[model samples]
Target: MKTLINFAVILFFAIAFNGIAYSNDECSFNGIDDVLYFQENSISNLREITVEACVKVNSFSARKSGANEIWQFIIFKKNQLDHFNEGFAIYLDEKNERFATSVASAKGIQAVIVDKKHSVELGRWYRLRMSANSKEIKFFVDGVLVKSAPTGFPLDFDSEELFIGGRTKILKDKDFEGRFCGSIKNIKIWSKVLDEDD
Candidate 1:
């Protein structure tokens, strides 16, 4: 992991100004409609990847779908319309009060969902980490390993645009409701699968 961190190429990516605000050393998102966009070229084509973020969720959206599906995205990059596609995402399952991470392929969405034991609470900060490769996907909360699952799929995806805090350009509509309401900071991404030691 150390060697990969040192030698592998890292893309810091662009952060476009949106409704989000940087205050007290973190970017705060209004649950209504706040999002940050990343440049396409900087975050595309990864075989193995690791993503980490420090977050404090203020509140989830009050609205719920007919099916009672509620999702609050932390990091998302995929076809907005389809779930079974080429991409990966990390999001909060608002209905279940847990964090979920998944990678998509033609086979379907392969996910590792954190158990109810690590439920996300309001106004508290959490260090969330996810690492994925062709063999497995692992998720962590703070420094503790939560869940690891076998997920054999290439991490590379077709979409170049990436989003943080919420799904891009879809917050106004209720059709794809996964806008996140939280404070996020110290986001790091690596184009290599990081180990537990990292």
Candidate 2:
């Protein structure tokens, strides 16, 4: 009877170990050619927005070599035809090893804020959050407010696509060449800015 009980315990341990080893909770990007996009009809025309993600960066280096600064985008939605046009984006700066977010209005006004105080470490998962409204924009890391600033105008973009992990077109400078090299999961988006306490 004791031998049978020991076998059952070992069986349970094996199942649990395999479950964790093959977990598929996060989406991994190759930092090259791996991208997820949604049509504007599915997600667009937001007066205010909040984006949240659980991200673990594998690397911040660009695929191409000549760019001055490397940018790895986690979520990018902007005009496909125009570079740096009206839209919103959340990305990491390779040089600074920090998170940055930007919002643009249809009228060409733009606002950007970076988490200057916090530098993210590679292979560490972070709960990155950005909330933007007509009045202001806020950036949070791991539930802590990192940066906030008054937005020049409410974010309004007529982009035809919403991209996760990468974009359709490469920027002129090509600094953001590699896209994002990381695992992202639990991405949440809201039409209304969520209260901090919530």
Candidate 3:
């Protein structure tokens, strides 16, 4: 009788532990080629959006031109790479040694690049958040606001997909120029602009 009771207790604990592990696994992204693509209907329009993720920068490299940096995370229109008419990207600028964010639209590209001195260190985990609406756009690192700017044009969400850990083309092309070497987890997306307190 005692053995039966002990066996039941162990089984209960095992099931509980497995549930916790599975929950964590749902949000984690590992490897240089890790990406999560969303179906068009899976996500709502991107007019006002918030993207948050916990990232550990394993490495950083400049793109082919060496002028534009590699984006670590991007919400982009399919098949539109360099001249994306509607999209947003967060990247590490090796040349300037700073973290940067860019929001592009048919109107123009509005970039909020941190100064060279505010570069993020490698092999450290940091919470990166970006919120945008028609009025403005904001970037945050480690729960602190790093950059903010006015945003007049709304993001185009038609046929959009989310790219994590690295850009889409770089993953397929095996191009190290704009590839991200890192681990990303706990990615959350919202259809509405999130407040500072959120």
Score each candidate by Cα lDDT: 0.67, 0.68, 0.54
TM-score per prediction, in order, is 0.81, 0.78, 0.68
lDDT of 1 by residue, 1-198 (tens): 332232111112223235356654577777667777655554566777888878887885633322336778888777323545436778887777777787765456555556563488989999888888888888888888888888876565655567777655654443465677888887777888776577
Worst 10-residue lDDT window for candidate 1 reads 4-13
The TM-score measured for candidate 2 stands at 0.78
If both were scored by lDDT, which would come out higher, candidate 1 or candidate 3? 1
lDDT of 3 at 110: 61
Candidate 3: tens digits of C-alpha lDDT, residues 14-66: 33533312233223333343444434443435577777767666555523323
lDDT score for residue 34 of model 2: 60
| Prediction 3 TM-score vs. true | 0.68
Whole-model lDDT, candidate 2? Answer: 0.68
Best by TM-score: 1
Over 4 Å off, model 3: 1-36, 40-44, 62-86, 115-118, 169-177
Which portions of model 1 miss their true places by more than 4 Å?
Answer: 1-16, 62-68, 79-81, 106-109, 172-175
Order the candidate numbers by TM-score, best to worst. 1, 2, 3
User: Candidate 2 at residue 71, lDDT?
Assistant: 73
